[model samples]
Target chain A: MDFSSKLLEQAVLEMSQLPGIGKRTALRLVLHLLKQPEMQTLQLTDALSNLRTQIKLCKNCHNISDTDLCEICANPTRVKEIVCVVEDIRDVMAIENTGQYRGLYHVLGGKISPMDGIGPSQLKIKSLIDKVREGEIEEIIFALSSTLEGDTTNFYIFKQLEGLEIKTSTIARGISVGDELEYADEVTLGRSIANRVPFESSLKS
Target chain B: MDFSSKLLEQAVLEMSQLPGIGKRTALRLVLHLLKQPEMQTLQLTDALSNLRTQIKLCKNCHNISDTDLCEICANPTRVKEIVCVVEDIRDVMAIENTGQYRGLYHVLGGKISPMDGIGPSQLKIKSLIDKVREGEIEEIIFALSSTLEGDTTNFYIFKQLEGLEIKTSTIARGISVGDELEYADEVTLGRSIANRVPFESSLKS
Candidate 1:
């Protein structure tokens, strides 16, 4: 990590600040940039700077967006009355990629992790409550990961909407479609049995 | 991978172009940047843009530098008469970390690889030859990797300097110090034996 040039050292330090990147990987990446045409670096810098400066959260869903309303929330064809609550935009992207869910999304930005000082108040919980109380939303789907913090956040939000007459549901947790039954974890295998769906419903595409 | 925002998609695309990064990792990094203050992104962009736009290479050794001469080439204590030729700045850094070699370095930029459309002429071979012909250099250490391309580049330079009186040697190829004998590859084990040094020389720290 002892870069001979101060500029190189600064660049490597900034690069390594990324979540999983280390000093060695940062050096490798910076050196790779040095080898490529300056246009590549310029493009990357421009993209990053522009993203930081110009990006906005979707006013309705709290998803990262260039406009006040995100594309999904703005689309009239999407089921606006049915909202999918997700931890972040990646979850939104993952769910969108499946093309099965046509509902709008509400990004919580993160889960309720007291260890990390993240809690319900820091999230978009109040905004979500406002949306639910507006009376148009019929169903709210909880799509957070099945982690401890995820469950805590889900329950916190569910309790807030308790007095309201809206239906709330969570994403089904079970063995992956192609995974062998024997390889499935005990908790998931047991849940799949206890919450077994109608045989005909499983036959749907 | 269908990002709702064009800015996000472009940023992710540029980020993923880095070696060993992928679309998912890129998204994670971009989202992490979004979660942080704008200052972090600005700092990163400024560093990268500055590095790309203002960085220079050493005129003598072709290493990335802020000035015409890199630190090693400008140092009076490092032996200018003994040069360790390497593939790139990373190799130079690796050797420098050892603190054993007290000589200047000539960065080839890359090894000769016909498959990659890189040849001797594309490298800094001519400048290296010019340095040798200046007649002050007494030893030229071939410190390139032991890959086929590395060997090809080393041999190409060796043939060029065949008539010169300077000493030439490759870094030793052997099983690593702590590697188990049973796990050592036959080629490396054999080469280590063939190129064995004096037992007393090995004992030197």
Candidate 2:
């Protein structure tokens, strides 16, 4: 599209560089910012700049943080010996929202996706393994998604801790709590049946 | 959702302020930026800041521009005596892309919508009238949308120029060029039939 101003075109071009935003949507967003108070634009840019410049990664688990260690890692109440392994901070937030698990998280940053050129070295797998080898963590729960890359990353880490004294486990795969049995996919349904737990154990949770 | 970092929360909060963007989508976009190189975030913020700080509005048409007068208004080849009235710069760009209109544009900024607290006095309608009164314009084309607010704005401007000698016309409302007749809405179909042009006039265009 022909923009009357170079500044507008530049802004839209940069805005469209985002993952899901297109040029037209970027134009609409930029025009919206133009129509709003100047303070809105300033605040947005300032916040983004501050995030990129000043944000930190938790030294312990690689999760995003405002300080050297994330809130979960700094909290003494969280169980540091039982580390939940997952991909990125979104997963960490999802698990935290559940209020079920009190263990600390080890953010892998990403899965072992060879197609995207992301391998074991690109993630925080080494740090997690080092923590386990140092005898700081007693249990490692694989909380990654059920995708092939997730399984591959989990198996790779499990193999790294082969001779270690730490106990390893994975989050259970099952039909959703409220979903009907008929709608469940075959793989998940089969897994749920194969890994059936005692009725009293389910009630305890 | 609980964000691990204050900077991340602030960035997501500011990003979500844009139209149509929700908190989850904002978090995703912000996290995507975090994963990318820091330079990407810097460039995006710089572009937005530059656009907001340095952008200019065309004095003649009120369209977004990099100069005092817009390109269309500055171009000597464009017809100076005919002006197409639009609601905003988006309309100006849309018409310019068609490559059919050679006349200049007058961007009204917005329509007269009482529900939105917008009125004639808030738009650029006065400047358009002033230009017409100075005998600088021979024709005024209403290219606003076909909504009630658009028609009200058009009729209000039409009344203001009741005693003027200049010709006044509106863009033809019809089924879109490639649209099927069966899918056409009742109001547009009726208007298209009532305002059907002569066969020779249609062929001339």
Interface RMSD of each: 0.9, 0.7
Candidate 1 lDDT tens digits, B133-180: 889899999998888999899999999998888999878899898999
In angstroms, what RMSD does candidate 1 have relative to the true structure?
1.5
lDDT of 1: 0.92
- lDDT for A15 in candidate 1 is 92
* Full-model lDDT, candidate 2: 0.94
Over 4 Å off, model 1 = none
Model 2: per-residue lDDT, tens digit, A58-163?
9998999999988999999998899999998889989989999999999999999999999999999898888988998989999999899999999999999999
DockQ of each: 0.82, 0.89
Which residues of candidate 2, in runs, are more than 4 Å off?
none
Candidate 2, residues B38-120, lDDT tens digits: the string is 99999999999999988988999899999999888999999999999999988998999989999999999999999999999
Model 2 docking tier (incorrect/acceptable/medium/high): high
The Cα error of candidate 2 at residue B63, in Å, is 0.4
